[model samples]
Target chain A: MALCEAEKTFILHSVEENFRIDGRQRGDYRPMELETNIVAPSFGSARLRLANTDVLVSVKLEIDSPTLEQPKLGKIEFFVDCSANATPDFEGRGGDNLATEISNCLSSAYKSSTAFDAGKLCILKGSKCWKLYVDILLLECGGNLYDAVSLAVKAALWDTRIPLVKSVVVDGNKVDMEVSDELFDCERLDVTGAPIMVTVCKIGDQCIVDPTTAEEHCSGGSVVVAVSKSNFSTILQTGGGSLHPMTLLESLKLGQTVAQRLDSTLINTLKQINDNSTDVGFLK
Target chain B: MSKKKELVSKIGLRLDGRRADELRRVRCKMGVFSQPDGSAYIEQGLTKVLAAVYGPHQVRGNRSKAQHDSAIVNCQFSMAVFSTSERKKRPRGDRKSSEMSIHLRQALLAAIKVELYPWSQIDIYVEVLHADGGVYPACVNAATLALIDAGIPLKEYVCACSASLANNDIPMVDISHQEEMLGGPTLTIAALPMSEKIVLMEMSQRFHIDHLPKVMAKALKGCKDIKVILDEAVRSHVEDVGCSTGWSNTSQKIKV
Candidate 1:
């Protein structure tokens, strides 16, 4: 969506006045609706709608050997698929660049030990571990995709449950493990330190947390900051324009504060989610 | 060898307890999104599909492909990585997905009034959230609802259904994934329910030629049944939108 000079000026002036076209202040995020465990087959799943940016994240687990360098840690991989339903422009491989960008950001954000501890996923140290495939499907693109995707990913991770292993026997380099037969015999993943990303868009002089598509188009530059607990995990500069060092620092601070608030709110919401609630996947 | 499990039991009930002719529960809602011109979500038993329609606008990417007499109908069918029991490496661009996309276009092209907007294009995208069974049929049904929500002109509703031979004697409608895995010849057909026209027909694992007519007839009946359900949903959706806009209750309006 191309914005005319006048429209861009209007958005810039609105930002300078500490107001946005969508009636949100610089720090206010749009209303978000989140649901977890919607996908029946996956280990864990979540669907989040930050206004209109719809993101669905599903986690599938597979047993595999841990990486040679990281013998004590398991693995987590992020794959983002841009569904054409979001837009015609993303029909074939057109959305690959954006998908790659987002997935890379997520992988980097979760790379740190403090952000996400993969050691708990390890089953038999270097021999066997659970590999998490975090698949994100982009159903719609309203705006603030980074924030929405991260929130959904975090929720899905929180909802993930690893099957409990009864016993593991290692005999002459051959390992055998017995998993509990009970359906509900599982261990929930610890997501206290899971990173939450916030995309702070710099329009004119002010930075905004959640920018609509129109606001994104008008913004000169944006910083995506992934905050895990109190520390910044991965900070990425997106879009074409560049920002001054002082402005970048200011935006980073803004993103960290907003991300902390968002993370706490999401954790509270997840705690309140009823497991027996009727699954309303997409029908609603 | 162990005795083969039954696709349909002697009592005529299938594995899921559905009768030989009964379809799985179908629940759907239209206009689920605000960004797209039209969008819909449909759940056929455990298989869920979401479809979005955009256009009747000027052709994108390749202007040279624009037609002089009819618009191009572009369709994309994608399944989520976690849709099936095992995770898929890629959502689309696979051979099966490409073929499904082509089949979806063929089914939709038969009903859509493409000539109404020449030199234009209509884009339809369907994403499978779950893949219990009859994925193509669910996608077709969902796309039809999205087209209607987009207010696209159509000759008639295009509904798709699957049928399979159970025990090599009885014909069953709405083949679930379990039934498909249980060794049976499955036939799928996409048809214009009102006109009784078959747009696309595909069969897997050949059966006796003598069984074709019975299976085809069962599948056609299934299509008609699905059409009725889709029509009712579309009507209610339209009525809901109309009521919300104050267009349905004209008598309540005061004289200007």
Candidate 2:
């Protein structure tokens, strides 16, 4: 997906005129399709296909003892597997670097307790807590992976339901929790404040949102902003190039605006998916 | 006698209510992606696979590995983390996936006309979206479609199938996930179906030498049958793609 200097200049000129190669406005996003509750057997699952980039997210939860340092807070871990379906380069351990980078960004974005509220995941103070494993599969990688992965994760968490715990019995340093047997008996997690990531690729003095693969290769650098409804949760700059502080601040502003819209659209879409009467999976 | 009776019951049907030699319904689509040079999606019963082919270009990495005789064929086998009943720790890189990768490369190398592009590389990437059974066969079939879509020269279409010795008496073709779980000696083979040449053959569990020949022969028949289906699919796909570029005068509009 390499772009020559001439092509880069053309893209810059188009962006300066507030247009893109695909006829999108500078702030416009490509058409996206999302589906939730795709994996019926899992606690929660969602697949987000933003144009060519496809992300499938599944959540698995289990009750375990809380860590010694974070007794009051439960655990939420992110694992991203870059399937070879995306590209042959991802075969074997080749995709490990990309997967690790995505998961690290996600863990940092959700590190703030206010962003996810792990405290609610706790069951018995220092004794027991729910561990949420958010496993992401990269089926296709067209570009804008950060934003797509975050959107899918948020939707999956929104759909996740912790099984109902009826009661707990503790005796002789042993704790037994009675989980409800009814299939529908469950408790939903609070995801209102979950952070959504927005990637801004710096292309020829202009910052663009959701850059395609070719655009990404042409960019000198990029900034990833994770925004919650309240405020910015984390901001990380990636790529080989460097950015000025003032420019970084300006990029953050752009990210903030784009991220707010992204969050609202995601919330509305998740609602629509829930209200609909269809099962979501790759069948479609 | 009781085991044979159990395999083919009063209705003389195998598990999943299919006859002994019946093949599972196959559904496939070509050019499933825009990024890859060629891409395909396939479904056999509940088993689903996606394959993408990326090259016929200069060899990547070490030039020393390149041979002047033929193009290097690279194959990768990966399963989705949630593709199975239980979550997988990793999608690939395990010994099993490595072996599958080797087998896939071997089969494709036999089918592809690699001599045309000496010192080059052709990548075949297969991902199992859902693993019911017959995963290897489905992967091979899908990869063949993708390679064709890439317009890579091929000596012939490579097809694969799985056969099982049910009740140690009857040979069942196209074993499904349920049947594979039921426990039996499963035989899998990839072949150049038209030429009737075996590219790769594998077996799990043990079978008597007398019964092995019949089971292998049955599996080869299944592979040949699948090859016909795949060939038809390739032709139809080419026709459809050809019509899309305003080359064909049919004036039929397709909504892709």
Largest lDDT belongs to which candidate?
A: 1
State the DockQ of every prediction: 0.84, 0.44
Give a tens-digit lDDT track for model 2, residues A1-284: 66788998888888788888888877778899888887644789888999999998989887888999999999998999988778767776888999999999999999998898999989998999999989998988989999999999999999998999899898879999999999889998889899999999888778889988878887778999999995999888887798878878889999999999999988987777644576424534
What would you estimate as the lDDT of candidate 1? 0.94
Q: How far off is residue A163 in model 2, in Å?
A: 3.6
- TM-score (chain A) of candidate 1? 0.99
Docking class of 2: acceptable
CA lDDT, every prediction? 0.94, 0.87
DockQ of 1: 0.84
Candidate 1 chain B: worst-modelled 10 consecutive residues by lDDT: B247-256
Give i-RMS (Å) per prediction.
0.6, 2.2
**CA deviation > 4 Å runs, candidate 2:** A39-41, A166-182, A274-284, B1-9, B13-15, B250-256
lDDT tens per residue, model 2, B58-173: 88888998989989998989887777877788788889899999999998989999989898999889988779999999999999999999999898889999998887788889
